[model samples]
Target: MLPGVVGTIQATEAVKLLLGIGEPLIGRLLTYDALGMRFREVRLRRDPKCPLCGTAPTITDLAVHRNGAGGACDVSPDGHPEGVAAAVAPKAGG
Candidate 1:
């Protein structure tokens, strides 16, 4: 949800709510397996250019590419070799 929006609950609030009911999960790692069962926490990284929560300028849209072999790349807003379709495609009938 957009920050500062009315009636929008923040992540901190959500965590607090869970903790209030004896389900405190702060600092506790959580993970899911291929069967969708809770497992353990794994290492993760924060993208400096993530549109949702990054230091770079916000991006309105994102383009995704894959090689059908589990390999993928996340393109940024700026035009780059990895950004094949950063901008929206023109309407075909327009």
Candidate 2:
């Protein structure tokens, strides 16, 4: 039920954006409170340092997806498998 509601909102927003018919949710956050049956909107500010949306974005290319070794799916930047820690602490007085 919750997912359906969110998906409908997202689809509606996409249509509005493509047609430029009504105001979109750009630069804003829309939150749904199912328990309270309420919806709230909050203005959002763009961060200049954001990796994907920043002034000088580093993720502008698709190189990350082409690697194939986890690529975009790899959560760790250190090349460790997902859910595995990159480093482990030394044993006390090892």
Top TM-score hit: 2
Candidate 2 lDDT over 1-92, as tens digits, reads 88788889999999998998988998777877689999977666776655567677777777878888665544335432222121232233
Per-residue lDDT tens digits for candidate 1, residues 45-91, read 45456655567745444533234533334443462333213333323
TM value for model 2? 0.61
Residue pairs clashing in model 1 are none
Off by over 4 Å in 2: 65-94
Clashes of 2: 0
- TM for every model, in the order presented, reads 0.29, 0.61
| Alpha carbon lDDT of each predicted model | 0.43, 0.67
The TM-score, computed over Cα atoms with residue i paired to residue i, of candidate 1 is 0.29
Q: Which ten residues in a row have the lowest lDDT in candidate 2?
A: 81-90
